[model samples]
Target: MGDEVKLFGMWASAFSRRVELALKLKGIQYEYIEEDLSNKSDLLLKNNPVHKKVPVLVHNGNSIAESLVILEYIDETWKVNPILPQDPYARAMARFWGRFIDEKVIGTLHRAIIFEGKEQEENIKEVHKELKLLENEVKGKDFFGGDTIGYVDIVAQVVAFWVELLQEIGGLELLTKDKFSFLYEWIGKLQNIEAVNECRPPREKHLEYIRALVENAKSGSK
Candidate 1:
C-alpha cells in the first residue's frame, strides 16, 4: 500500500466537503467511505473515539479527525498547490477568517435556521453581524486570500453554501446583492472555480434535504 488514503464522510456535511475539496485541490487520491450519522460505523468510532465525526482522514493506516485539522495535514503532506499562505502574517489572516466563519457565521446560522422563538432572533442578529464582517473582509479581493483561492477562500465557500441553504429553509434571505455586494461577488468568484464547481451538490437536492431537516427539528421541539 503506497500511501493509501481514505476519507470517512457524510454526503451532506460541510465538514466532509471541506476535506474533499482540499484533497481534490491538491490532486491527492483517496477512497471515500460514506458514514450514516444515525448508525455510525464501528471503524469511524474507532478512528475518532472522541468526536466520532465524519471527514476522518486515514492515510496509510494513520487516522486524523476534524475537517480543518485534516485540511492542514493534507497540505503539509502533499506540499503541492499550497492551500495556506507561506507568509506568516498572511497565514495568520487566513486562519483568522477561517476560524471566524467556522465559529461565528456557521454557528449562528445553525441556531437561527434550526431553532425557534427568541433564540432564533438572537442568532439571526449575530449571523447578520458576522456576514457584514465577512463582506468587509472580501472587499476589493477576488478571493478571501486576495487574488488566490486558499484556506480562507475554502472556509468562506463552505459557509456561503450552507448560509444559502439555511436562508431558503428559514424563508429569510440575509445576504442579498444590495446588502452584501462584496460577499455576493466573492461567492460568484468562488463558484466559478473548477474545484468548487465540481464538488458542489445540486441546489435542489440540498434544499430538499434542508427542508426535511427543518421540519424534523420543529416536530421534535413541539
Candidate 2:
C-alpha cells in the first residue's frame, strides 16, 4: 500500500516476472524500475551490490535480491493472497519445486533450445525427464499449490510462456499436450490467470529475441 515498494527488473526476464507476478497477486502497489541489463543502473548495483542483478525488490528502503527470495518476502510482507501456503511442509514443498523450476527446468530448456545437432537432442531428452518429475510434483492439482497460482506457478512463468516460444523457434516440440500433458494443462491454467498473462512477455517478441540470441552465439563462436 505504501509508495515505498519498488521493483528493479527487465521486461523479458523470467526471474523478474516472478517478482512482478507475486506483487500483483498479493495486490501490493509497487513502482517498477526497468533495468538495462547490458548497462545496469546505479540503483540496481547499489541495492544488490553483490549480484548487481535485476528483479531486486526494495521495500521501505530495504532491498531483497533473487526473484524466488523476493517472492517469499512479498508473501511474508503482504498477508493477503498468500503466495506460499501456511503449512510448514506445504510451504517447503512449494519452495522446493520453485527452486527446481529455476535450477533444473529452465537451464535444461535453455540448452535444448539454443544448442543444435546431438547436443540439442540430448538436452531435449533431459528436458523431458525433468518435466516428467515436475509433472509428478503436481499430483493432479490444478496448480502446484492446490487451486491458486502460488510460488511454484510464479517460478514456472518460463515454462508456461517463454519455453513454448523457444521450442517453436528452435523447431522443437518439447512440452506438448501429448508428451507433457500435465505441464501442458498446467500452462493453460496459469496463462488463464490475468496476473501471469500480463506479466509474461509477448510470445512473438520473446521468440524474436531468442532467435537473436542464437544468432549472436553463432557469431561469437566464429
Candidate 3:
C-alpha cells in the first residue's frame, strides 16, 4: 500500500486513542506523532484550524479532524477489518450512538467525576440517566456492534475505561455492575480486544493525570 497514514494525538486523550484503535483494527500502518496540547504544533493547528485539537488523521496529505469522522474515513479507505457495519441503517445507528456518546455522555460523565456534593450528585444522576439508555441499547448484545467491536464500540472507549477511574477518584458509583451489567460486560469485552487494549493510555499514568486534574479542580474551587 502506497497510502501514507499519520495520526497527531495526545497520549492521554480518549479521542486520540479511538483513532489509534481504528487504525490498529484495520491493520493500517502509520506514523504516530505525539502532540503537546499545552503548546500546539503548527501542523496540528494547520490541519485542524477550526478545532485545533489532537487526533487529526492525515492520509496521503489530506487531513481529517474529529475522531468520529476519522474513524469513518479509515473504514472507507481501508477495506480490511470493517469498523462500521455493512448494513446502511446499522451504520447510521452506529454514527448516531457515536455522536450521542461524545456529545451527551462523555461531558456529563466528566462533570460527574470532578464536581463535589450537590453538583456532583446532580451530574451523577444525569450520567445514570444517559447511561441507562446505553445500558438498554446493549442489553442483548455483546457489543454495540453486535458480536464484533465496531464504530460505536470504538467510539465508546471513554465509557469502557476512563470513567471507571474517574469514578474511583471522585468516590462516585456511576457504572456499577448491578446497575449496568450489560454495559459493564460490554466494557470487559472491549478491554479484552488486544488491538483496542493496546491503544489505551497506561493505567497508572492515566490515573495520576486524572488525580492531578481533580486536585486542580479542588484548588480552583477554593
Candidate 4:
C-alpha cells in the first residue's frame, strides 16, 4: 500500500536514535525493530552482513547499513521536514560537523570515560579539544542548525544526551558548563525538542546499562 520502511536499532545506541530522530522529523511512519546486539537477529544479520551492526534501515526490502547513510537517505527520500540544510555550502558544513562528531567527539568521550590512568587523562583532554571546536560552531546559535535541531544536532545526540548520562555513571567530567557553555545550553535545547526527546532511552535503565559497561571495562583492565 505504502512505502515499507523499517529500522533495526538498539534502544541505547545514539546512532540508532539519530535515524529515529530523522524519520520522526520528516513525519515518516515506519516500523521500528529493537535489536539485541549480543545475539543479533537473522534479519539484522542478513540486512547488514558486513558489519552486523544495529541501525540497519530496510526500505521496501532494500537494506541500508550505517546510521549516517540512513539519515541522508531518509532526508532525500522524504523531503518533507528537511533534516539537512538546503544550501549547497550549508549542507556540506552540516555533513562536516556530523562527521567530526562521529569521528572525533563520540569515541574520544567514550574512551575518556572507560579508560583509566594516563589513558583516561589523555582522552579527557582530547574530549575538551574536540568539544571546543563544536562550541565554536554553536556560538551565536540556538542549535547546530541555528534555529532548530538539524543534521549536526541529530548526529550529536551522543554528546547531548548519552555523554551526560555516561558522565554521571562513570564519575567523570568532560562536558562542563564552565568549559563549553554553548554546548551545555545546546544540550538543553536539543533535549527540549519533542522529536529528539521522544527518541531517547529511559534515563534510569540507560544509566544502569552504562554502569555495567564501566564495571566490565574496569574488570577487563585489571
Candidate 4 residue-wise lDDT, 96-128, digit = tens: 999999888878987887788999999999998
- Residue 56 lDDT (model 4): 96
> Is 2 or 3 the stronger prediction by lDDT?
3
* Tens-digit per-residue lDDT, 59-133, candidate 1: 999999988788889888999999999899988887888888887777677778877789888888888788898
Give the candidates in order of TM-score, highest first.
4, 3, 2, 1
Off by over 4 Å in 3: 218-222
Candidate 4 residue spans exceeding 4 A from truth: none
Query: How far is 190's C-alpha from truth in model 4 (Å)?
Result: 1.7
Give candidate 1's error at residue 61 in angstroms.
0.9
Q: Which runs of model 1 end up more than 4 angstroms from their true locations? A: none
Question: In model 1, which residue pairs have backbone atoms overlapping below 3 Å?
Answer: none
Per TM-score, the best of the predicted structures is 4
Clashes of each: 0, 0, 0, 0
- Model 4 residue 74 CA deviation in Å: 0.6
lDDT of each model, Cα atoms only?
Answer: 0.84, 0.85, 0.90, 0.89
Can you rank all candidates by lDDT, best first?
A: 3, 4, 2, 1
What's the lDDT for residue 86 in model 3?
A: 95
- C-alpha TM-scores of all predictions: 0.93, 0.94, 0.95, 0.96
Predicted structure 3: lDDT: 0.90
